[model samples]
Target: MGHYSLGVDIGGTFTDIVLLDVQSGDHFSHKELTTPDQPELGVLRGVRILLKRCAVQPQQVVRVVHATTLFTNALIERRGAVTGMITTEGFRDVLEIGRERRYDLYDNFLELIEPLVPRELRLEVAERTEPDGSISRPLDRDQLLAAGQKLKTLGVESIAVAFLHSYRNPEHETAAVQMLQAQLPGIAISSSAAVVAEIREYERFSTTVANAYVKPLADRYISSLEDSLRQEGITAPLFLMQSNGGLVHTKEAKRLPVQLLESGPAAGALVAAQFGRDVSETKILAFDMGGTTAKLSVIEDGEPLVAYTFEAARQKRFRTGSGLPIKISTIELIEIGAGGGSIAHVDHLGLLKVGPRSAGSQPGPACYQKGGEHPTVTDANLCLGYLNPDTFAGGTMKISEAAAKQALDTVAKTLDMDTASCVPGVTDVVNENMAAAARVHIAERGGDAREYSLLVTGGGGPLHGYSVAKKLRLRRMLCPPSAGVASALGLLIAPPKVTRVTTFSNRLSQIKIDALEHAYQELEASAVQTLKESGASSTALVTRRYADLRFVGQGFELVTELPAGPYGDSTPDRIRELFADEYKRVFAITPPVNDVEIVNVRIDVSGAADAKLGKQRDEAATESRVPVRRKAYCPDLAKTVDMPVHQRANLVAGATVAGPAIVEESVSTLIVGSHGSFELLENGIIAVELNTGDRA
Candidate 1:
């Protein structure tokens, strides 16, 4: 008897499910169209299909890990619950005022992001706390109750309480929350200190408000999903993927759903890092292109970069300050609206543009035959012969080539070109868009894209990775098996972790060692409690410490790992040396006179590490089946060519394929250009090497 783990990841267009046997290291996967009206319905359907396909019983499932983009979608679509905010008097407009910096300076029609909570719903109460954790003005209980009653009368479903200096002292906010919860019994309440206990007021309040806005929705969905699973005979413990690339208990997720804003993308990055480590490639560029968006992340030394702040629903995709900011630890990545279902059209200036809008699963690509008439990247790929209509999705789903052509023709007529000619332009535009976004993201982090190997995952990633890599002047790419569901698999491989952070600003030289020790001790206690709630034993817990340090006057801080210890006089000097080393590594120079300041401390406690999946076993070599040849458009040659198509499953280890070929897998396809070649590694990964001639 063996225990099994199920991983479910709900993306914008698809729900991916992976079921893995812990003892035998075997797995099964399935993908289904996401039900936007009820996302959990898709999850349940995928799970049922996958379990039946694998002939596994629901009782064998011991754990369930899930990641979803529902919260992110709700924020972008403004479909969340009616939410209100309560703050200290005179600070009710903090969310609207927001740093008072315009994202675009010269534009006369600049539109800043509107706060989630409107001005009328943002009530104020008389309460104040000093930065030093002292209560300057006692919380006005009567005023707080009146505000709560007003919100209740207005039919607000959720409330966020953010007072001035709440991060320093949560007493006032906590008191307000108690009163609100007592009066409005069914209403959801979120406090800034509990959601994101950081110093920045705008980010903290935004994060708390966002959490409250989504809490009722998440709570209902999770509860419904649990009940559905129970009815289906699954008694497993449920965990959720967090934006920080860790898994937390369902209880924790319901309390702070804002931390799951980028959960799906973070899982993809984790899987990319795992694959990079497996191949011994430390510098990796993780590129994941699914149906609705493309995500790119950089990994160094088998670790992805982590940031304490993230933005959502950006008005401008490439601009940093054009979105609502949330303060939560997350993997740093850049996401663009380049994906398989991205629509292509001619703009008002007659220039061709490929999406910031998508035809998601409901009416996906024209080839899907679900009544979509718009030309999309998938339609272009189909028209260009990059996709096989007969074998798409293992032939379970039919593709309409006529529909694809009709869709492409509409856009082609607008561009004044034949469909064949427009096919390459559409694909090239999307690939270039991704390449440009990757370049900007890497350059901003002081990295050179040419120095990294691209690890491609997701359905569209392997299809377009070669071209994207060529644009970036990269020569290597790796596509793992079952790439379409890699993110779901990542959930199975992730370790259960809990991270706790607190602001502890102090100059390094003048820091009180006793206070620092107490802070860490408290964080560790909290982390331990969280991990315990997630089912990790005390003996199996491993704690790591980090400190955010910067020059006294700097606006941003860099995190450095600190050694476990009871701090003494000598520990500060060691900490300084670590900071200097890190500074030199990042900036290539160490300042001489500026004193270092500690801004925040973080604690990460993780459970026992997950076992890695075993490599695919090799079978006895047999006579290779004759490759099928198809006439496909070659972007490099600017014409159609007779390209060979090989089934990925039939290609054994050490098998090689030349350029201008298509390697078709059950769920994805890899298109190798004329100047590129691919070799199947023993680990079931395709290593693609692109020559310089592959560039456009």
Candidate 2:
């Protein structure tokens, strides 16, 4: 039987599935509305659709690599299983106490982020380990067994074990877990040492607890998916897309679902990187706007920037320390509530406001006629002539113009404006919100967004990308072919990877070089074994080393990469020089000589790049045919005008379309405005060049 590989990504609104022929790079894709109540339902449904479209039998499928936001949604909605935490006697309140810093100092009512685990549920045990891995007091077996018995009686869904300094010596935590397993046979257990293995007791414990909270759900879903696929006669080893822009075994992902929290958006960054390589630009801003949210990520040198820790499901939107912090490496990206499903309405002050709320896929936008009465971003686009009502979702779902008009009229009346004026106003407001978010995000990262090109993807991205880019003063925008499904396509190209971190505090000047080298070697060996267990071949193994370093007096540190070679074998002078350089890069200056400490060491293992990794560019290929032109309004120039309507399949590589045109594809449409033009690139990407002479 011919073999096929599938890449599936489940987003808030839609579940995307891409099936590819193993030898050939040819692929087929399907998009189905996600069943939020039962996300796996949509996944299975999308897979079936993909198989039928590709004319492949289930047994012919070789492997399936998937990414999903299910775990993230559970955390956001606070729907995950109830979880309990076990910590050293005095540290039971770490999750509750948090950093104890107020985000807004001036506010009369300072709202503290609620702890993931409540105080009553946090159980304590008598166990202690020093930073140097010396046992201060041995574990009290009776105390641990009683805690386990109490937890079992409490009906806790899962348990997190985070004793003092577990990162340095996990013996106590591991022993406690072993005892708990004997008492509580089916309870899900997680330890800070295995989850993050970093300093900062509060942060590490919180991260592990969060991981434990989602463990059962993630494991069940992944197991169900595997069983369903196996029953269908597909036997290929399953891989999963991770937040770090790489893939890993499904089994490994189930144990540490926190790493997969940002999986969907990370895929978009990968696809953006591929696009950047095509144009010879290493710096890019990946803009992925889908039905429920928009994601923005920075890419430099063909790699998506990574952050060691991230917060999820913030009670306060757009603020740090307001969510559950996960201590796992992930592609650093910003997500906002501006997307196709974002509702537009006039607030109490009569000012038109776009959303931090969405209609999502169930009710969707009013244009979808799915019982939604609110005027969403999609409705605004439809009313403003930016979308083809009848051709939405490739005509599988016909849109209702009447519903869109009615919804827009309600907002218009509330704002004391006509529908015609309200339509553009809504779209403009939403576009500005997105641009503002991008600006704040870029500024915080010490980068000017104007210097980078915007690579737009997702269903609504291409429609609003130009205006957003204009707001940021970016000259060019690129709407890759199948931009709406780019995240899923990115999954097809991701390589298998895994990361492990260990906290070992020491003065680089005083520590024995040989001892440090030995520790690093041990970490590397563990990483290699994990990769192999996850199906990576010996020849495919690749490793990268990093250190979390800072001045001895500093409370926090930045992650810096070590030069390729044997880790920790360098001289003290070399180590000091490297640290100083990185410190200067981050803080613009280095501290005077005192002492330097390396708090953590991280190792990442990535498999060899897939043979079918890159996209094919048939530069010699031409557009098949051109369709007739049509009249479409151009809001950029603030006028209704005639515009060319071209089928995406018929657009050749050299095909050029001036401003005021709609390039229609099965997944989404690209709107070239009055002052803009589009030309197909060497690949299938559509280069949208604005009047500034820069193509996006």
Off by over 4 Å in 2: 567-569, 611-624, 693-696
Error of 2 at 590 (Å): 2.3
lDDT of 2 by residue, 1-696 (tens): 756788888887777777777677766667788888878788888787767765789888877888888889888888887898988999998887888877676777867777777887899988789888999899999999888888879899899999998888999988988888888988999878888888898789888988999999998999988888787777888888889988888768887888888999998999899888888877788999999999999889978889998888886788787777788889999998888889997778878898878998888889888899999988888876767766676555788878999999998898878888878888889889889988998888788888888899999889888888878878778988768788988888888888888887888877777766766778888777778887788786888878888888888888988765554456555767888888887678776866788888887888874636434321122354656566666857786777777777667688677877887777787877777788988777888877755434
In order, what is each prediction's RMSD in angstroms? 2.0, 2.4
Model 2 lDDT at residue 477:
86
Best by TM-score: 1
Give per-residue CA lDDT, model 1, range 523-589, as digits (tens).
Answer: 9998899888888888988888899999878898999999996788888888999999999988999
Candidates in order have lDDT scores of 0.87, 0.82
TM-score of each predicted structure versus truth: 0.97, 0.96
The collision pairs in model 1 are none
Which ranges in model 1 have alpha carbons more than 4 Å from their true place? 615-624, 693-696
